[model samples]
Target: MKNSTCLQPSLATTVALPVIYSFLFPAGLFGNILAAWIFSKQAPTKRTQYVYLSNLVTANLLICSTMPLLATYFARGHQWTYQSVVCRIANNFGTLIMHVSMYVTIVILCSIALSQYATLKKNSDAKHSPAANENFHRCVLNKFRQPEFAKYLCIVIWLTVFCITVAAIIRNNILANAVGEFHTCYSISIEAGKFTSMLAASLATACFFVSFMTVLLSYYCLNRHLSKIQKNTCIGEKHLIYGTVKRNILVIQIILTVCFLPYNIFSPFFYVLLPGNDCKKSNYLVEIKNFLNCLAAAKSSLDPVIYLLLDKTFKRSLYGLFTKSIPEHHKGKADIFTEETPDI
Candidate 1:
């Protein structure tokens, strides 16, 4: 976003953003490195979740890596003093990391939801058919049960995000108009046309809702199925499974709400609320957007803590590292969403 006099961030916001980014940089760097190391210890091919989680850790690291440049930008009175190319790279990378991390987290939630759905289906089939080993059920069970599937999914996601990000970078740089002595990189300037603003707003709205709806649907389906299972049969591991699913749902809910929801909801408006159209409104919206983006960036710093809290293996490893105690050697497949097999 361009630094226009018509929509300058408040003095407080300028100072606050740098301070927040500075804190996030070191904290996110250390935490994500630890997370990546722990995730890498498990072979991704062996545990499909390890692939998604490993990519998520890397994505967060990328987000964190952009903090220094951002902190500099903010500290320099919210202006870009660097080369245009460097500024573009830093700006584009920050957005890219955010989108990639969000989609990867969505994929993780999908993986968990699909696994639970398959189990529910298999149970339903078992009740109906005396022969629980039916081919149909087996096929359904194995649908998304492959590590290769997850790898391919991640590859596709990365490629798509790369294309979208590159397009955004090109559009922003091409459309930018200098507001003053300092050239603004992505100006919704009076000189620039409305095409870029329209395109960006449309894209932002679509991306936000798609991811939001997916998470909501996944949570709803899992909760409904779990409720049915509990009512039908209160068996061993029932409470444990319910507890795990609920925790996963709540964590994802909080992460998305904090990181993506507010930024996405208001970003389109920020783009369209141009300086020429309404100076006061534009300035207010710009500051609000800046604050929301800062909150979104904080997700990178928070994700490692989320993993430590939610993933048993990660928690144990972290504990052992701090306490200087020998950690238990985990055996077999690490289940991310099951208490029985504790790993992420």
Candidate 2:
């Protein structure tokens, strides 16, 4: 039988993670911070997309916040020198941040779907009364679309994620106590740890499918609505709207798959679920898990880049930061989000 020690990841095998972290930590820090700064400079608008985008930037900031500890962990060759409690907190906080990012992205896509529906209603029913149109607008964009709603939603998400993080931290600390080690944390080793890891993986798998479907449904609805308008509108205008919406949709899909899917799908396999010991294979599996873990971290940084590409307001704010003097007319908050992107 292969020796159990051989199953432990070697320095060579572990090298990739710290290298990834080296880049992710700096990039995520710069990008997320810039995103937050840009969002801060803008005033809250009546547009529902502004609320959703704000929440997304907040989530991205949380996700990026975990990188310093992670970079240090990998820098030290997989042995966490921090206290066991700190280790547990860091790991679980990372989990909390990831879930927040996932849920916010789902909400953003769903809102886009809702916007598409509203546009269809307005376009198809030209004879609709002014009162009826106002009612429709309020229903679609103002019921729970206010900055106040976003504030409450974030509070609820933070509370829920906090509970889960605490539970995870407790479990890890309990296991660390049982093993007579109070300086390191492992995701899977004993029966309890394996069980917990599997449970988390199951949850992540469910989220993956749900979010993917939500994005697809949003894209389909938006495309259908755009198609209906193509006949009446100028060809150039129709194609521009269609192309921009499609581009944004594609960005959403790429980020969702690239960041979350690997960790969700392969995390379960990292545990030795079968009866027999296979240390060599197990080690390889764990290495893959770590690699995916780094990829997941990359999303926090990439999200800000997405915002820069897709959000005209955010792009202007970002551009304003570097330029010493913006024209007096361009500096106002109201001017930032007024660029028309058709129905998007």
Misplaced by over 4 Å in model 1 are 1-4, 42-45, 77-86, 93-142, 177-182, 185-194, 197-201, 275-277, 322-344
RMSD of each: 4.8, 5.1
Off by over 4 Å in 2: 1-7, 43-46, 77-148, 175-187, 190-192, 231-239, 268-276, 324-344
Candidate 1: minimum summed lDDT over ten consecutive residues — where? Answer: 185-194
Best by TM-score: 1
The window of 10 residues in a row where model 2 has the poorest summed lDDT is: 332-341
What is candidate 1's local distance difference test score? 0.62
**Compared with the true structure, what per-residue lDDT tens digits does model 2 show for residues 1-344?**
32223345566445666667667777877887887777767735655556656666777676667666665554442354335555655565555565556545555544544443344334333533336556765464444444566556656755654565446556755765676553334323421243554565566566567767776766776567566556555546446545655666666767767776777677555543433466566656666766776776687778777777666667667766788555565444222122243432
What's each prediction's TM-score?
A: 0.80, 0.75
Q: Model 1, range 43-124, lDDT digits (tens) per residue?
A: 3446655666777777788778878877765555336532466555655666566556655555555555555445444554
Candidate 1 TM-score versus the reference: 0.80
Q: What local lDDT does model 1 show for residue 261?
A: 81
Report the lDDT of model 2 for residue 90: 57
